[model samples]
Target chain A: MLTKRIIPCLDIKDGRTVKGVNFADLRDAGDPIELGARYASQGADELVYLDITATQQDRRTFSALVREIARHLDIPFTVGGGISSINDVAPLLEAGADKVSINSAAVRNPQLIDELAREFGSQMVVLAIDARKSGNQWQVFTNGGTQPTEKKLFSWAKEGQERGAGEILFTSMDHDGMKQGFAIDPIQKLSRLLNIPVIASGGAGRQEDFLSVFKLGEADAALAAGIFHFGQLSLPTLKQYLSKNGVIVR
Target chain B: MKTVIIKYQGGNVQSVAFALERLGASATVTDDADTIRTADRVIFPGVGEAGSTMKYLRERKLDQLIPSLEQPVLGICLGMQLMCRFSEENNTRCMGIFDVDVVKFPAKPLKVPHMGWNSLHNTKDWIGDSLDGKFAYFVHSFFAPLNPCTVAEVTYGRPFSAALRTNNFFAVQFHPEKSGDSGMRILKAFLDQSA
Candidate 1:
């Protein structure tokens, strides 16, 4: 049986990790490379570096930071944000990133997914969906969850899978940074509907939340930010707890 | 001494070469057989369809030359699969250096590509202290089953050969070059063996 993965997401801006309170009030945490190594040593199954800054200056810094992290870390890392072309993914992957996650570019041109999947196998391409609840349904958001789209969560996810996304990283805006728990109902439905692995992100406050996503939500992986960056919950301790609760974690 | 990484229209050789440079070894990327045969060690790393890759190798006469080498040869991922007798991927015939067949994991709830780090158990003595019971990085849908040639084993849906060795020919289903410290140790060990 495949073990569930625990990931720590680091939002990179100007080559430094910037931690925010509910995606606002950003503060510099540390160097992206150092933070990545710390998380990997702490037993993070994977690391996600989202380039939060959209400027040209920030992009170069982010690329440099990605090269630094890729040189040091051994685990799989996913780099995202501001990636608009197939050419954009090449340098990041060549720099040592195992996978590249596309958000705004992918939603705009779904054909990019097929082109990327064809050039660099589906396993190397990840589709990140930033979703927020709209009345009874979840709506996909673009541009780091600022702009909204009419595409429903389930339909967009299905489209992404059909377009050859190897995995889906679903982040719920409502539960993000709240520390309440994961939005399990919608995630579980998506997981059941999609054959590819689904990584549940947002609202992971405690060890039980991780277990809940794995057991109840049936997510292939769980990704948290605030808890890990602030040193509130460590990965090894969490993995030990999950193992005790009959969750197979490696 | 510089290492020659054989690049024959395959996968992940540039990354593997970059990894070699990080380990203080100068690496040259080329498909020229002379360049590969003259290097201190040759790394054949690839990621793609097995049948197409073997076809490419045969077209270049690399299929006939790889097994006849006297120097240390390391194959990673699909490169390792191509070293076996046959593969279930595209019903491809492979190099007969190791008498094993690569088969896909049976249909299950588990993902087709067994991606991520898995422990390699039941290691052979030749593996030395460099690689024994240590986890290595693997990403592949098809695997080579265990036999007398198996040097290490890892379990997914079932136990499979993670590493196989037969004289100068060494192949690992996992990517040692990308597997961090444990993987680096394996590369160092291979270097030591060749030296």
Candidate 2:
């Protein structure tokens, strides 16, 4: 049986992890390689490194970091943030990132999804959508969730799947950084709508939040940044909590 | 022992190389036929559509060159699918090293990609000894069905060959390079195979 995935996201800035990672053995929180290795050892199903700024010069540093991270990790890792074209995706994949995720760029140009899926199989492409609840509907946001788009959440997810996105990562702008819990309504809706796996992002405060997202949200995977970076919760404990709660976690 | 990773367009080669590096073996990634044929162990790793990948291999004549080799050749993911007789993916024919067909996973209740880790069972003395009841990471839509050559098996919606071995040729539908310690041990066992 396929198990639920537990992912720890690392926000990278200037080639360093943004948050101070508090893994027990590692002293350097800025060292993404160390944090990633720690997460893997602690039974993280996968890892995601988001380049916060993704400047022209930072791409080089991010690429280098990806190479070092890949060399150290045996599990799959994904690279996202500012990946707009095949040119941006190639270096990261060449650097050993198992998958490359697209966000604002994919919304700006939906054909980019097709091009990426064609060049490197769909499994290598991840479509991340940032959204917020508006009235009775959810609105898709872009440009680091600062710009609101006319596209709705469910339709865009369907379109992404039609264009061959391997997985859909839904990040709730309202729920992001809230420490309350995930946007259960949106996650459950998307999980029912998309045929591919849906990864619920944002709003994980407690261990029960993980269980809630898995059991209630029906998410194939859950990604958290602060909870993991600040050592609010470790992956092993989280997996154990989920396992004991009737959720099949790896 | 020297290891050569057969590199072609649309394949994830770095993780495989890193996996070997973790086991104290540095691998050389190459597409040259001569380098591949002469290597102690050859690894054919890929992550792409079967038809296009086969075209790339045929353009470089790797199709004919791959099957004629005498060394222990390991095919992974699309590599294993391409090693079979045919693939329903884009309606392409493949190398007939393993007489099996790669078919798409059924839609609806069971997901297509069959992504994530799955346990392997049913043992073959040489390759399956250490891997019995061990989990390995897999990410693929099409799978090779159970056959005479199947050594390790796993089930998603139905039973499928997780690992297949026949003399000098060996292949796995899972990504040993990305499957943590168990995967590394499998790769080590493959490398430990006497040539």
Candidate 3:
């Protein structure tokens, strides 16, 4: 059986790992290479590095960090953040990232998704959508959730799958950093609506949240940053918790 | 022992090389027929479209050179698909080294690119049955159904060939290079065949 994936997201800024609550109030997590190696040792199914670095100069550092992280990790990992074009993706993959995630830039130029999927098979491309529920509908947000777009969550995700995204990583902005639980309703709806794998992000406070997301939300994988980063939950223990609760994890 | 990784557009060569390095063996990433043919073991790693990758292989005549060689050759992911008779992906014909057809996973409400870690069963040969029931990372949409050559099996939607072997050629649908320690042991086993 294909076990549900447990991912620890490392938010990288200026070459250091940090986690924010609701995408603000950043805190030092540790060195990415060390943290990544730690998670890999503890049984993280996959790792994702969101390069929240703002300037282009720091971009080189992020690639270097990715290379170092790749050297240390045997498990697969995805790299993203500010990746808008095929050019930006080539370097990260060259540096040994297994996959690349595209967010705001993809929304800005939706054609980028098609180009990436065509050039490098859809399996190598992941489309991340950050959205918030407004008036009973999830609205797509961009620029680190500070700006809103015309795309609705479900429709845009369906379009992404049609456009050749290998997987859909849906992060709920409203539920992000809440530590309450995952946004199960929309996640379940998205899982049913798409043929591709859905990775649920945001709102993981306890180990039970991981189980609920996989069991209730039907998420193929659940990703969290703060809970894992702050030691609020360790991946091995969480996997044990899920396994005992009838959720298969790896 | 010398190892050569076939240099092609699709193969995720760097990680494979890194894994070999982890095992204390170094590999050369190359497209030259001589370099690949002369090596003790050749690795055909791939992760690109079938039609285009086949075209690249044919244009460079790797399609012919691959099957003619006698040394142990390992194919990963798309590399494994291309070693088959044909693929549903882009309707492209493959190298025919393995007597199997690569078909896309059925649209049965299950995910297409069945991503994440999955366990392997009924393992033998270079894959090592000791590693049976061990988890390996997988990310693919197309798979080869069970056949006489299958040495290992993994079920996702249905039982499929996770690993196949015949004489000097071996292939695996999963990315063993990125599948943690369990995968490392598989690579080590493949390398051990160099004896």
Candidate 4:
């Protein structure tokens, strides 16, 4: 039986790790490499480094930071944000990233997903969808959750799977950083809809939130930022809690 | 000393080389027999269909050359499957280095490709100490059944061989390259083995 994964997401800007309250009011965390090593040692199953800044200068800095983080830990790390083309993925994977995640670029050009899945196996490409509830439907959001998409969540997820996305990292814009809990309804719906593994992100206030996602939402993994960054919950402690709750974790 | 990664139209060699470089070991990626034969340790890392990979290996005469190696050799993922007797994928014949057959998971609601972290139990030899009940990442649709060569086991819808060892040749169905520190420790242990 595969165990549930615990991931720590480090949002990067200007080569430094930062966290925000609902993707606003960015606050510096620490050097990315140092923080990545710390998380790896703390038993984070994987690390996600997303470059929040869209500028060319920050992109270069983010790439440099990825190399530094890759140097410090021997774990699977994913690099996302500002990934526009097939060419964009090569540098990050070359710089020691195990996987490259795409968001806005993938939505704009669904063909890019197939192209990437052909070039690099589907396992190397991760599709990250930021979703927000719109009326009765959960809709896709882009541009750091500031822009909304017309595509329905289920349709986009199905397309992503068909286009060969190895994994789906789903983040609920409404629950992000609030830590009240995960947006279980959307996650359960998407997980049932997609064949690929779904990693639920956002709204993990306590360890039970992770348990809730795995048991109720059927998520393959859970990714948290603020709880991990602010030292409110540690990976080991969370794993222990999940294990006690009858959820297999490692 | 530089490590040589046998490039046979597989996957994860770049990441494996990069991981080694971070661990203070320089690595060379090539399919050249001479380069592989002369390297300190040869890593046969692959990810793809079994028959096709073996076809490529035989085309380059590496199929015969790999088994003759006296140095430590590590096989990852599909590389491990090709090192076995036969694979269920496409009903293909394999290298037969290990006396086991790769079979598809029994049909059910369970996913075909068992993807994610799973614990390795019932171990032996070099892998026994590090991976007993320890989680390692796995992603495969087919698996090699437990046999005399089975070193570690992981349960995913069914219990199967996660690691297998036969003399100087060690193969793991899971990607130790992407399996985090415990995985790195396995790599370091393999590198430290005495040939």
lDDT of each: 0.83, 0.88, 0.91, 0.85
TM-score of every candidate relative to the true structure: 0.91, 0.96, 0.98, 0.91
Q: Per TM-score, what order, best first?
A: 3, 2, 4, 1
Between prediction 2 and prediction 3, the one with superior TM-score is 3
Instruction: Quote the positional error of residue B78 for candidate 3 in Å.
Output: 0.7
Q: Alpha-carbon error at B182 in model 1, in Å?
A: 2.7
Off by over 4 Å in 3: none
Better of 1 and 4 by DockQ: 4
Error of 4 at B15 (Å): 3.4
Comparing candidate 1 with candidate 3, which one achieves the higher TM-score?
Answer: 3
- The count of backbone overlaps in candidate 4 is 1
Worst 10 residues of 4 chain B by lDDT: B105-114
Candidate 4 residue A167 Cα shift, in angstroms, is 1.2
Query: Where does candidate 2 stray beyond 4 Å?
Result: A19-29
- On the 0 to 100 scale, the lDDT of residue A14 in model 3 is 82
Q: Which 10 successive residues of model 3 chain A have the least lDDT summed?
A: A53-62
Clashes of 2: 0
Q: What is the DockQ of candidate 4?
A: 0.49
Q: How far is each candidate from the true structure, as Cα RMSD in Å?
A: 2.5, 2.9, 1.0, 2.5
Scanning candidate 2 chain A in windows of ten residues, the lowest lDDT window is A19-28
DockQ comparisons of all candidates to the true complex: 0.40, 0.79, 0.81, 0.49
Q: lDDT by residue for model 1 over B27-112, one digit each (tens)?
A: 88888888877877888888767877898889989998898888888888888899999999889999988899999887476765
Preferred candidate (DockQ higher): 2 or 4: 2
Candidate 3 residue pairs in backbone clash:
none
Query: How well does model 3 score by local distance difference test?
Result: 0.91
